[model samples]
Target: MTRNLILGALLSSLVLLLAAVSFIWTPFDHAAMNIPAKLQTPSAQHWLGTDHFGRDLMSMIMVGARTSIAVALVAVGIGMGAGVPLGLAAAARKGSWLDELIMRGNDLVFAFPSLVIAILITAVLGAGAVNAIIAIGIFNIPVFARITRGAALSLWEREFILAARVAGKGAARISAEHILPNVMNLLIVQGTIQFSLGILAEAGLSYVGLGAQPPTPSWGRMLAD
Candidate 1:
């Protein structure tokens, strides 16, 4: 593996381990406050010291990692679950009104950024992690749909796809069996990119006060403070 990949793996593993451990234990209760200790410098008693609220920074950070991970993970899942099938259908029906409709819908969604979408949803739902996830997920659907459709289109004309059609396999079957497998590598790469973007999106929402609420520490909120 490349050096960058190795370093990334190690760092990711460390973060995952820290988040997991946080569920069972932390240096101190993340929400517990000791106002007198606020802004104390890092020391043996508090490796990362204290925040302005006097909460343990390290504990807050540990819990925050999981919160970010959970939001990003679920948002990406929502995107892939909804987007992949829509893309496949559009690709299979290429040139049909169905294809036109799906693509046009994607275009409509693409017009709005995730932040804009978040603001709209949060306006109705009130700001929270769930609303942020929904916003990010909606934005992601068009992205994954576009990627899947484009990749699937190239494979549609391949000899194997043509042969599958001749063998009485339907569009859905061919897409699931043939097209999806061929495009999976591309999707995996795209998913990784999306996952990172999801984290950033979550952070942005939190920073703007549209994400996880107080008592549920967020990296973005920490930065804001």
Candidate 2:
């Protein structure tokens, strides 16, 4: 990886590590409010000072990172698992009714912003992490589906794909063995792109009171406050 990529990765990893550590041990109880120490500047006692609520800012921030990371990871997982298969299937059956249906469905999903969809889902499901994950994950589906379908379609015409068909390989077999392997790099790039988006989505949802419920620090909620 490039130096920039390495640095970004390290920083991201470090934040996640600190967040995990905070779950087990924060210098002060994150939820405990101390009016006496409220709004104090960063000092030996409170490294990042206290918030308006007198809660430890650093502790709250660490927990927020953990919540954001967890939501994003799960949301992306849902997208990749469901979207990749849909894309591959659509590509394998190119020109068929199935392809049209899938792409049309993707377009429909793409029409709405994830945050809007999340708000709707939260309204129904009563606003929580699981509901937020479902909302964001559903949104990611179309994005990955489009990327996978486009990349997989190109691979479908490759030499190996034709050879696989000639060798009596079924559509599923060819897609799994030949097409998937070749398009993985593209998928990886798409995945990286989507992950950042997922984090942002989680933040947005939390800000709107539709994600990561109370007692769980959320970056978006903190910002909204």
Candidate 3:
């Protein structure tokens, strides 16, 4: 299990690094068209075959990496940034009206399928990469919040929490110092899961013409074409 986890993490890291590098430099101009070379099979000149439009498939795939990673990172960041805090607050104030409100909001958001929500947001905000990110990010909020809240509730009853309270440490301080550290491992695991979902979501949005705009090179749009 450990070795497998290490291998998976290394592979994911390598992919992310390659994606980042592709943003700065790819083997060829992804948008450049060569009608004569259209649909050419992979060769020395093109590591991957040319597409129907004669764009280098390798380059386009590399460019697509940039879009996928960017959307996933931004979406996950937005979800964690907003959701974690709300979750912590709710956990600290468990059973209060605010806690009830937050959980109910999460449930309401959860009731909508992520794809449907993405479509609605894209329709309202106009189709674009930004809209896709917002949609995915919003969809992820409930997931992160629920995970954090569940983990935090368990930690809140621990001895350290009692000690902190006995020492007169404030709620926010205890949560930040104690609860966050204990739950960070869980968060990291959840973040990785969300990242995978974000990639799928971005691809779906792009396929439907609601994600990256033209010439941006998204895998979803490429598959759609």
Best by TM-score: 1
Model 1 is weakest, by summed lDDT over 10 consecutive residues, at: 114-123
What tens digits encode model 2's per-residue C-alpha lDDT throughout 4-30?
A: 989999998998798789879877877
TM per prediction: 0.95, 0.93, 0.94
The model with the greatest lDDT is 3
Candidate 3 structure quality by residue, lDDT tens digits, 84-179: 998999999999998999999999998889889998999899999999999999988889999999999998999979999999999899889999
TM-score of 2: 0.93
Clashes of each: 0, 0, 0
Candidate 1 colliding pairs: none
Give the alpha-carbon lDDT of every model: 0.90, 0.86, 0.92
As a whole number from 0 to 100, the lDDT of residue 7 in candidate 1 is 100
After superposing candidate 3 on the true structure, give the runs of residues whose Cα lies further than 4 Å from its correct spot: 1-14
Q: Worst 10-residue stretch by lDDT in candidate 3? A: 14-23
